[model samples]
Target: MKTRSKIEEEYWEALERLKSGTTKSVDTKSTRFKFTKDAVGREAGRGKGYVRYERYPLLCEAIADAEEARKKNGPATPTANAKLEQQKALKQKAIGDYNQLKQEYDLLMTEYLNVVRRNFELETGLAETKDVKIIRIPNVR
Candidate 1:
């Protein structure tokens, strides 16, 4: 088993490297940073406010492994088994992350549309305000 302290230390180190700006090797992808206002103040904004790097992929793979383990173990396996339960929990977390990203992407798209619509409205001197509203409804299971 990996030491949690070591894991946490590494996590913080990686975060610090990120915070301090790590060197990007030639192979690394170049991404743009945007400036945006927050409740506190303006801070650097990720294009879509998404973390799309090593940790994201690792989390995704862990979730997949968990799912596979769950399927392989089947209903006969005790659901309370620590490993299986942990895997299930991780899978749920990944799903939640995916859902959250989807929602955020949808919202950004809507915001982009509104901005474009308003730009066109201004250019054409149109008084139509119908297309500026954003409506979000949650699905009930």
Candidate 2:
């Protein structure tokens, strides 16, 4: 068994490598140990050029490991199903919240785009107006 500090140190070194643009790959060892970019980054010191999970094998292994763990531990006992069901319910609730936030974000983005477009149109119209005059108002004490 690896000590907590050792594992953390490995992860941190790997992340530092990544941040320095030296680390190239995300390796899930044949031993089934998976390391994700976010996981690595969370364990890592912060800085730019932090080559994260972006365009990389990030979620694939950790998710697979979680699924495997879930499958392996699933429901041998009669009460296990109940616990599993509760876990599923919680996961579903989290998914629901994520979807709700996504929808709200999409709506907000659309609204913002419309506002920007309107502002752009207004500005263009104002710019094109021949009768518009610019007058500097002097500050009066």
RMSD of each: 22.5, 16.1
Largest lDDT belongs to which candidate? 2
Worst 10 residues of 1 by lDDT: 34-43
Residues 1-141, model 1: lDDT tens digits:
543454434433443333344523111122332111110011112223243335354533443454465456445534568778889899999999999999999999999999999987785554455656544589999
Candidate 2 wrongly placed segments (more than 4 Å): 1-78, 133-141
Q: What is the lDDT of residue 31 in candidate 1?
A: 33
lDDT of 2 at 112: 100
lDDT tens readout by residue for model 2, 1-141: 533455445555765553344554543322343344454544454333343344233333543465466457544444788989989999999999999999999999999999999988987788788988645589999
TM-score for each prediction? 0.31, 0.37
In order, the Cα lDDT scores of the candidates are 0.47, 0.58
Clashes of each: 0, 0
As for candidate 1, its clashing pairs are none
Among all windows of 10 consecutive residues in model 2, the one with the lowest summed lDDT is 26-35
